[model samples]
Target: MSPTTVAVRAGFRRGAIELRNTFTNAQDLWGYLFPTLILVVTIFFMRGSTVPGTDFSLGARTLPSALGMGLAFGGLIALAQQLVVEREDGTLLRAKATPNGMLGYLVGKLTLMSTTALASMLIQLVPSLFLVDGLRLTSAGAWLTLLWVAVLGLVATLPLGAVIGSLIESARNLGLVMLPMMGLIALSGIFYPINGYPGWLQAVAQVFPIYWLGLGMRSALLPDALAAVELGGSWRHLETLGVLGSWAVLGLVLAPVVLRRMARRESGSRVAARRERAMRQVF
Candidate 1:
């Protein structure tokens, strides 16, 4: 087999091992379960409340939106955090030294990210079905929409995460990303409608993937009539596709260049320096 093909196969195997480890490794499993639990509890409380104008369950609406947000979190923040932490710990340096190791590592991360996102969605969704009413995953159309939205969401966010991860010098500086991400989450209409926000704010929110991801998920899982509460009184699937696709394209174009540059800079000396800095921080 060609080197490229070998790299791909190794990547798949590494991803599978990582996925299994996520469950069997106690710390990793807690990292996986805690967020799902928090989202579930948040939705459970929201179930008793109805939408602003309509009698529909707000919790049900929030469920899919939260899933979308979770997807974004998985692709962006989670992936970035992994890269930063691993990079500091010399994983990237180790990969850089091996033949086609970076390729395998990248593939493994993609696999881990998408699988974990789906697991999280299912974990949140199954319990949500019992807690919240009016989620419609029964139809083929709904499932298809969900699939496409999720695929697009990951595409749009992961490469961007890679770029961000490449840029961030230290894992400690992750707060810079986290604060902004929290602001985006608040603006993206995950738990509430964005229709009431200022026109300019709505315009700004629509430009980002987080809003579109949440909108796409809501479109997939919620009933058509629920669209009334959404901006323009519709799901705006075309816009969602356009915006997310644009981001995906931009990220794809940038990630490899950035990652390559970052990898080129990685060396034993740099890794040692990073470790020293981290140790200093602890001491």
Candidate 2:
């Protein structure tokens, strides 16, 4: 087959496999549903109040931040943990032996993870439009901003997940990897305004992508008057795109390299020995 044809066929097959895997996993269902529900409830009941430091209603600012958070947790952390466990179990190694196998496997994972993230965003949006009082989305600009930020946020975070998955040894060790990421999320102002954080904490938050993502989404979703509110020492929108784009570039370069290295380490005999040792310890 021509290389083009081969690549096209591989992508299609990988997508189908990913769809099947996503549907079969109840955990994916919960990952999409729970954050969406929380977003809906928070927007519906809390729209009237201001989001502290901003003139927009709490509902207006909260939705985008919540959606960003959902994407981070659902796409990055969840997918990374799954990849680590699957790699430890020899599933990734088995897949790698097939035609275009590694590409297909990654395609499936990305499709499933992105779908869940997008679904979670939409679920929150639906309730925010009709049920949430004082929630305004008057400008087409706001919608445009929301879409851009969400897509960029996913792009920036997913590859980092891939890299993390490649580095970790087991599911139990995921906590060590995840705790730092969770801290990033909190520092990014996903649940609250960053202004409340001390100067040093704000400086620390600037080092990660999540804070920039939240800032960008807020810039896109919040009213123009409220855009002046600083996050991590700059106007929310000004620094967001630049920071996120940089992270996306970095992750794209690093993730595949990390995954390839991890794959080399998990050759058949190595996995078998590890499993045998694990079994012996357990029994």
Candidate 3:
């Protein structure tokens, strides 16, 4: 087999192994479930509440939005966190040292994260079905839309996560990534309508993938009549594709350049220095 094929197979195996490992570990399992549990509670409280100007349960609307947000969070924050922690602990250096290792490593990471994201979404979505009403998952068209939006959403966000991971020098600085993402989530219409926000804020939210992800999810899971509540009175399927596609292109272009620079700078001394600094900070 070709080296690329071999590397990809290795990556798939690596991702599978890591995914299995998460199930076996107590902390990993807890991490996976905690957010889900919180979301469940949030949805429960929202059952009585309706979207502004509509009878649809706000929580039901939130379910798909949250699922989309989960994709964004997984592709961006989770990957960035893993990269920072791994880089600090010298895992990245080891990958850099091996033949075709970086390719394998990246593939493994993307696979693991994508699967994890999907699993997390399902975990919440299935339980949520019992709690929320009016989801349109019964139709083939709805499911198809869900599938494409999710896959495209992953493609749009993961590379951007890689870029963030590559640029950040330390795990301790993850707050910088986390804080902005939280802000984006608020503006992205996860819990409410973007129409409620100022025009400038609405435009800002549109620039990121989170809003489009939420919009796509709503398009899939909500009824056609609900489209009246969205900004354009339609799902704007083409716009979702265009915005997310542009991000995918941008991320694909930048990830390699940034990741290479970050990897090239990794060395024994740098690792030790970072460890020492981390220790100093801990004390």
Pick the TM-score winner.
3
Best by lDDT: 3
Ranking by TM-score: 3, 1, 2
The lDDT values for all models are 0.91, 0.75, 0.93
Cα shift from native, residue 247, model 2 (Å) = 0.5
Residues 9-34, model 2: lDDT tens digits: 67667767776777678996676567
Clashing pairs in 2: none
Scanning candidate 2 in windows of ten residues, the lowest lDDT window is: 227-236
RMSD to native for every prediction? 1.1, 2.8, 0.9
lDDT for each residue of candidate 1 in 1-115, tens digit (9 for 90 to 100): 8998999898999999999988788898787688878877887777789999999988888888888999999999888999999999999999888899998999999898889
- Decide which is better by TM-score, 1 or 3: 3
Q: Compare candidates 2 and 3 on lDDT and give the better one.
A: 3
Which sequence of candidate numbers ranks them by lDDT, best first? 3, 1, 2
* Candidate 3: worst-modelled 10 consecutive residues by lDDT: 118-127
Question: What is the RMSD of candidate 3?
Answer: 0.9
Quote each prediction's TM-score: 0.97, 0.86, 0.98
Could you tell me the TM-score of candidate 3? 0.98
